[model samples]
Target: MSEDPASSRQSSRNQDKTWINRLMSGFSSEPKSREDLINIIKEAAANQLLDDEAVSMIEGAIDVHERQVREVMVPRSQMVVIGIEETPEQLLPTVIESAHSRFPVIGESADDIKGILLAKDLLPLILNGTEDFTLEKVIRPASIIPESKRLNVLLREFRENRYHMALVIDEYGAIAGLVTIEDVLEKIVGDIEDETDEEDEDGFIRKVSDNEYVIKALLPIDQFNDEFGAKFDDNEFDTIAGILIRAFGHLPSRNEHVEIDGFEFRVLYADSRQIHLIRLTIPES
Candidate 1:
């Protein structure tokens, strides 16, 4: 018996989709090595079969396998932690301020992490106004991973164990940083902006207020100038961070401000090394 041509074509299309999903999942029976899979993906991208975002995500997935936990985990200093002895009153404000779903419950300091505390777990207690709040009651054992752990392996463990956040430890068995499911996913799918992220129409510069715009320091200087209708020289620097560093003559700390070309560039958030977020205010002319 001969098969229907239409049915055969539909089956072929389904097989292709399955193949693409397997590639996306980073488990293809045909492509044994990373290079082989990447080459196939690049060929597909070059042929315009896969869109740019899809190609980029596929490339990111390959890169994730090559990366380690330490490379992607949020630095220890930047981690928001809840004190083990804190009352419900104190904890409520802290949770609201950070807007974080999960926080590490710490004993003496950030290094002395007790366990993971889910914000949702405290919702019922808060609603009932439970004065005698016990940290041990709500805290759950945290999953710990070595900084040297491979992303692919860690991701698999995360799925198997249903772990959302993991405490990354160093060679000394000290809390080095934190890695979340979101962080791991972002490594593949790129930055996942939250509801709090106030991005503008362009999606580069975010609106902070009537006159203030929170801009990503990585925005290209040319795009920055074009976005705000300002004249900023891109000859010496490529990105907004580059220009700011040039102007400051050193790495600017948080709250540092520089007025250039009628724009007030204030460092909304920064570290000793790089500016993460900047608030740019353009006075109404």
Candidate 2:
């Protein structure tokens, strides 16, 4: 992803200023006149200068439509789907097992999805009636996405439109998976947990596939360094994102992969040159 022409020119000006700042990094003696440096900075900013930091942010804006739900999804394997004819006894157990508050009701499998069901909706059925309970009556239809929509755009879509989940589709446009508000939020602010969430030393991280993990970026960087025993260098970056920009050499589009510390970091959403959303895949051993 590249910046707009106006923004690009501004970035060029900013890059020059970075060089100026760097040249001045270890100065033992300050410049004789403060006006010289002040004019340079004022000129750069007045011209709308931007540094590498500006590029990271601009890339997020340019690459919005290219990410997809599957890239940042709660995969089907981890999904909680129930058949339309599923008995309340069967339904209750699935809900309890997942500790999820919602379920998708389908006629046969998840592909034949009829609607979504919230656990609270099941409360009335739990105490009194299993006899007339049907999965179809309690589900909601939601917006869907292809496995190619950009996470940044999706984040805006989610925010402006207030969509909670988007059903991910394959090229043929059938549902291949789903992404939730939590899934998108995980990419941005990192993982979130509730009362029922399980705690493993591997705690809270959901292992959806062999290589893919739903983990919180907030988990201490040192913790990852210690746990995974990786030799990742965090020179100027404190989070996974700072490291990502260092690798790509520029801001990247959504779902674009780069190998770092033996794992593939896929951009889910990046706002302001920072990784607000991402999908991590372990590199092949």
The 0-to-1 C-alpha lDDT of every candidate, in the order given, reads 0.82, 0.65
Model 2 quality (TM-score): 0.54
Q: Write the residue-wise lDDT of candidate 2 on 151-209 in tens digits.
A: 77778888998657777778886677788778765544445788887665432345667
Question: What lDDT score is found at residue 249 in candidate 1?
Answer: 84
lDDT, candidate 1, 1-285, per-residue tens: 999999999998887787677556654467778778877787667655688889878787887787788767876867889999998878888888888999999999777889999989997883776766798988999888899999899999989998899999999999999999888888788779998666554436767568878788889888887778878888888889998898888899667899887788988555323676787889688
- Runs of candidate 1 with Cα error greater than 4 angstroms are 1-36, 200-233, 236-285
Q: What is the TM-score of each candidate against the true structure?
A: 0.64, 0.54
What would the TM-score be for candidate 1 when compared with the true structure?
0.64
On the 0 to 100 scale, the lDDT of residue 225 in model 1 is 72
Model 1, residue 95: displacement in angstroms? Answer: 0.7
Against the hidden true structure, what lDDT does model 2 obtain? 0.65
